[model samples]
Target chain A: MTTRILTPEELALLSLVQDELVPSYGDLPPAGTLGAALTVDAYLAEQPRLRRPVLTTLRAIEVRAGKAPFAELDAGRRVEVLRKVENADPESFSELVKQTYNAYYTRPDIQASLGIDNPPQPLGFELPAFDESRLSRVRAMGKLWRDD
Target chain B: MAAPELDSDVLIVGSGASGAAAAWSLSRGGLRVTCLEQGRWVDPSEYAHSRPDYELARQTSFAKDPNVRGWAADYPINNSGTPIYPLMVNAVGGSTVHWSGHFPRMRPSDFRVRTLDGVADDWPFTYWDLEPYYDLNDSMVGVSGLAGDPANPPRSPRQTPPLAFDAGCEAYLRGLENLGWHWWPCDNALISEPFGENRSPCNCCGPCDIGCPIGAMSSAHVTYWPKALAQGVQLITHARVEQITVDHAGQATGALYYDDHGVRRSHTAGVVVMAANGVGTPRLLLNSTSARFPNGLANNSGVVGAYLMFHPVAFVSGVFEEVVNGQRGPIGGLMNCQEFYETDLARGFVRGFELQLSRSVGPLSVANGGILGHPVPWGSEHHEALRSRYAHTMTTSVMLEDLPEPENRVTLDPELTDAHGIPAPRVEYRAGENTQRMLEFSIARARELFEAAGAVEILVDPLVQESGWHLMGTCRMGDDPERSVINGWGQAHECSNLFVIDGSTFTTSAAVNPTSTIQAVALRCADWLGRNYRDVAA
Candidate 1:
């Protein structure tokens, strides 16, 4: 039961928030389309310390919606609920947003889209060799050290 | 039951920068040296940058702040009043294992603060007195820089070429050039040319602070400890010294420590060296209460943990329209403008600051939130925000000179303690008025530079809380025993055979980083101890 952390309805609500946080634009799909919420769900299970804060933010928005589940709220109402939660408890709001992005961007597909397939190591980026000619003008000034 | 106590000719309390240098110097003079280090020796292969999840490790195991990355070896620090958080790593190399490797020597006037600015007291020794030692350390560490920098005195030519300013850094150089301000290529411990078989030339990994993926960066573990070990110096890892044990006659006998398996043990020596840095050194001294020295070990002057200093940092970043190399190359070794480093009372401050080009966020950082003042929207604008920020921004970190103030100090915290139940150190500090004034002046100057460099938007932060890397001046050295904890040549004023070779013994904190100066001073002190140990020990 601990392994299967998030309930189906809770996962659906989280997915809806993730979708709104990163909506589909151009040819790309929204975060929900890439199962970013599922990724976050797995992350939350891995880091149980984050479970309370993540749930607090989600529940705050859900409770802000009168009678309707956050997953069933209209897009405009969803934004209003999110904004209220953000205004009321910004730390928790920011926490969920940060974790969502971490889950999203670390995906293989997202890395491909960002044009950085490999990590920064093993094959680091190429930088232009520093040209010493840049020193000619500055070198002419000579020993500006304050010795007096 | 306690373990059998060991004895040595010389006992060093830490295996970090100063300890490594002291060990190597003393062993070369044919002394038996044994170093007790609290932390494990981190494998280079296990460094953060070697894995794909590099940035993640920085938030966890490899974090500079001991508080955030609560490894077993780390001690808690209470940074309540000060804006800057104490950032350090508890490993064989200490914080140098995770440093950005920006090595700059202090200017000549730095040692004569009272004579120059009428503020803090002068150091017991002058920069010229230490110049030869600095050159020796530079040669031993394999620094990369161009000599003949107008801002500092002439020196031996750098071993390798400096990391060239990339397309993005050129923007700032052009801005400074247009403004006619003095700028220079920064000296760095990070090597640009290949040296020994173990180390290779830089791979241009952007996150060098997370422990260099390649051995290009100079750290004590890679640079000095190898030579010291080759000279037959004994390094005992996971030996956390809790107290500097003193003999019945009030001389430093050795240390009492917890071994790897948590067994209490003692090691006696003819001479004792304290290289555990500003916070740790003072903490150990204060905790070592006794019949002869109830106040602390060699602390009869009551200045064991006084005059703590940190280069209070303020970050100024700018957003530009054109995207250049975002996360490539060495961050700290690129370029620096020291136009305002020397004291100029007319600028509304007695001392001044240095503006060094710093890091921009990686893709994950941008995705989290754009910048300090700028927030990236998550919806339709997320990609655009990430693209605009990652690699497209330039940050100039203003390092303000922290004058020595008795109030800005590290004291034993009343409530907090480390894992082994030793009372942790708490920092009671506030940015002095002079430092604040320098920040305002530097901010305006950075804004002008950014505008001149054609930045579309400028971001300003008054203080960077996580920028406290240069730790110094908790157990200062001076000529008078009444006015200082230690004296010239880093010998404790109260205990004859006791020595302090770490940043704790600094008299003043310059605006520049302290790694190179600390090593140079350590070399000088080790040389003195090697020559005069017979008199002191007797």
Candidate 2:
């Protein structure tokens, strides 16, 4: 369980990947620096079983980012390509987005540095932001449809 | 590494409700009880936050072994008529840790089913006999409910009040009421408010099927193990019991088992309690071949693993207009109807079902429905469907009680050892004709109720007549040694000091959840062991 390092090039590619996936407002740091700081390569190296799937998923993300052969795309084109993929299949993009997010969120250094909000809470206790107006309207409509 | 040899006054196998309860009871009695649990203790606080971390990918659903590498079933959902079905949980607290916590005591008539209704065999003990122990078990586990339901026997005062039913739940209630069925609040083993020392109130997050993070649900880890530890019970986790050892005089000696690290060890005790659940209990006994008892340990009657039973559960789901945050709270949040419990010759089914009401839906479930055409009227139909339907829908799940038959039994496979190299419990089971009829009736009733509730579209999932969870009847209780595995007091007929306290000892499958009754019997057995230890030892 020792710390390991990710190559700078791989870190930059991972960052370029994350920048395209998450909503800009969702409080995430740039992926490259976070990936570098996380020792992503070392973690993956230890998990030999997950290596193939992880690589395949990253390659899929790169292709979706229009970085054919992955190594070619700049950061801007990667974002544009990801937006297209996200629009086409949000389900497939979700895993990549979540992985990139967790990659940063799980690292203690990145977590503290970014002030990410992933504190411990009881199971099923996470509250969604309440939009009273939306909820009230929904409730009113539901009342109308009541079989009672 | 050399495995440590262990010895104790009591060697209890399996750490679910039964083992945990026995451990607590024996430990409190000043006995050197050693509990051998195959699964390791997983701290609740480890993944308390981040509910998604404990999903299927995490593989920690309902106290089953997280490390189980392959699917137990050779194939998925058997649509063909296969009599055999598998049910099991291999975890620290066994299945009890992850159960829905629906704690209903078996009714008085449930025990004397053969004598009263002549369908199943009569249990050696009656509900009146188990009443006090049931109360004690309920109090220990902290059940929350209201009494005075005319259908059920009067219950002792619950530790807490029933959970509040949500707004959408009334629709289903009305439908059940319209059909002239009586419904009552379910007896839940969850803390509605603060109870005895260290226990906290349930916040009703609705994901009790997954491990409860706050310890509000009555898993054995929270309920019995704590008391057992306080009373000096020695719990040996990851020690899988292989066989029960008996001496030349037909007396119980102890057991042989392997630790998590796969080193074999032996423990000697005056009494051996096989609380290894319905499946595990019989498997261990059958595997314990010896010169004195070659068939199996205490298999004098050749009925070590016969008459297995589990209630066939069918789930129903629908779409409503408002967001019913169904993803929170313990399973079976509400119990709407049980008027069908009585046997009606006219209904063409021997046993009736108890309707469990719940509305907890997770994101995966929501996403599942959205693709299944449950949502919007869309395009032009969008606003109309979204405005009118989603929040108003609520579903009632029926747990149909199945009759116990000898053909449905447990036996060992020549193949399949567990991760620790112990043979896995091979279950041979099938739903009886009576149970099949009950499922058909229950499904039709469910559809009727939904239609009456003005459901625009109601989808009925195929009936799965078997679940491995509520396993019972393999080592059933009765009066005659030739016919039964255990006596009325839960003592083995062949071995006086040996006992089976879990669902394996149940003679009949009650229409409700079995955890409360299992805990109750464990407590009663422990009490009996405390009084009669000297007589048996001599």
- How accurate locally is residue A6 in candidate 1, as Cα lDDT from 0 to 100? 81
**Each candidate: what lDDT?**
0.82, 0.65
Residue B222 shift from truth in candidate 2, angstroms: 1.1
**Native-structure RMSD, model 1:** 2.6
Backbone clashes under 3 angstroms, per model: 2, 25
Q: Write the per-residue lDDT of candidate 2 for residues A44-102, one digit (tens) a residue.
A: 56545444544555556656755264447765666566567666665555544444544
Off by over 4 Å in 2: A1-148, B1-6, B48-89, B368-393
Tens-place lDDT digits, model 1, residues B327-412: 67776677888888887778998867789876565676667643354557776677777777776888888887898888888888
Docking class of 2: incorrect
For model 1, the superposed segments whose C-alpha errors exceed 4 Å read A1-8, A42-49, B1-6, B369-375
- lDDT for A133 (candidate 1): 84
Residues B1-538 of candidate 2: C-alpha lDDT, one tens digit per residue: 0112427777898888899888887777677788888777766654433533333322223423322323221111221333424444556677765657788777777887787677878888778778998988887888888766566776788888877565545556556656755666778888787886676777766556656677788778888887888888888887777888888887778888887667898888888899988877998898888887788887878888888787777656554444454444454667646667768879997757877776644332232242122323112232234324333445566777778787777677666666555666666666778887887888777777766655566655535433446878889898889888899878989888789999999988878888889988998888888777766641
Which lDDT value does model 2 have at A145? Answer: 9
lDDT (Cα, 0-100) at A38 in candidate 2: 45
